[model samples]
Target: MTFQWDAIWGALPVLLEGAKLTLWISILGLLGGVVIGLVAGFARAYGGFFSNRLALVFIELIRGTPIMVQVMFIYFALPLMVPVRIDPFGAAVVTIMINSGAYIAEITRGAVLSINRGFREAGLALGLSGRDTLRYVIAPLAFRRMIPALGNQWIVSIKDTSLFIVIGVAELTRQGQEVIAGNFRAMEVWTAVAVIYLIITLALSYTLRRIEGRLKIL
Candidate 1:
């Protein structure tokens, strides 16, 4: 079939709206994930027994399950069990937060642990409190190491927004499918959709690389 530029032009607006929704959910989700990951990561890396165990359970459980299942459980099953219902957008954002946070927690823990213990000791010897040492000395170094892994997770989470189509969040892929349904131009519409996703990921990667360059520790 000849590619239809007309179909591409017609679908661009709808697809861009979908892309905006996709970015909205991903940004909100990832921001929450960063908060969760930092707390959980610090717990796993340095907390006492109970806190470490709790963080470990959370990280392991979320990482073990598929994100699609997580989304379905939030949007479908949770309503059955609880007295509340969640919309598709809420479910999508929550699932991304939980799923991405698990991986990010591990990334955080590893980065923190990888730093030399002598740095912490030196900070303490310089009369810094443990909390201040962590905040000032350890965090800076660890965050530099975390940049690449965190970037990968962010990119993956953005692409994974496509799976929300199962519950009908109207993200980019779902919008593309809808456009194709109306015009019967799957080839053109899907090509445009893929290009949009590629562009988003590439832009994210470039931004991350620039941040990494500015923060290079060594």
Candidate 2:
């Protein structure tokens, strides 16, 4: 009963700004993640032994750790390890990119490997080079199958932006926190924030599902 509707309204515009920033970060982060996933997935699929091992190690190491720890390391500990300190936004994007990449790499590898070997053999039998075989035969089918998994990872990446607030980036959750801290209307602020996230996530899910359905191997 203590919820103040007026406070929620007053905070709406700034929270919307925060939401836009969150979306920007998530999109850019996932784009980077997709590139990394594709490269690492290919390396695992067709690279020489050393390259394959390296790719596998990268995927495993990222997957094994909590993302919060990874983000903190990149933001706080990276300066000690390297010459430059990463800003909060950069750290958040890097965290999302790498974290999303690891999972997507695993998904990509699975999708690639799950394809029947006959398709690959047939491509080779047709005088296609190894590269051509992958491009024409393996990659097309594998990526088509990868849509759903990629969409799920995209959702995770979007949610992960909330964690960046720990480093002081004013994402949607952070903005909501600031509102509550100022107005002492935790219920109203948090409820508004939760609904905003839910709306976007549900919309993303719907869109992805439509794409998935259209792209299904039928």
Best by lDDT: 1
Query: What digit string (tens of lDDT, one per residue) describes model 1 on residues 96-159?
Result: 9999899889999999999999999999999999999999999989999999999999999999
Q: Measured by C-alpha RMSD in angstroms, how accurate is candidate 1?
A: 0.9
Q: What lDDT score is found at residue 170 in candidate 2?
A: 88
- For model 2, residues 1-218, the per-residue Cα lDDT tens digits are 76679988999998999899899999989999998998898889878899899999999999999999999999999999899989999999999999998888888889999899999999999999989999999999999999999988888888889988899998999999988888888888999999999998999999999999998993
- For all candidates in order, the CA lDDT equals 0.95, 0.91
Clash counts for all predictions: 0, 0
Candidate 2 global TM-score: 0.95
Model 2 CA deviation exceeding 4 Å by range = none
Residue pair clashes in candidate 1: none
- Candidate 2 scores a C-alpha RMSD against the true structure in Å of 1.2
Candidate No. with top TM-score: 1
lDDT of 2 at 29: 91
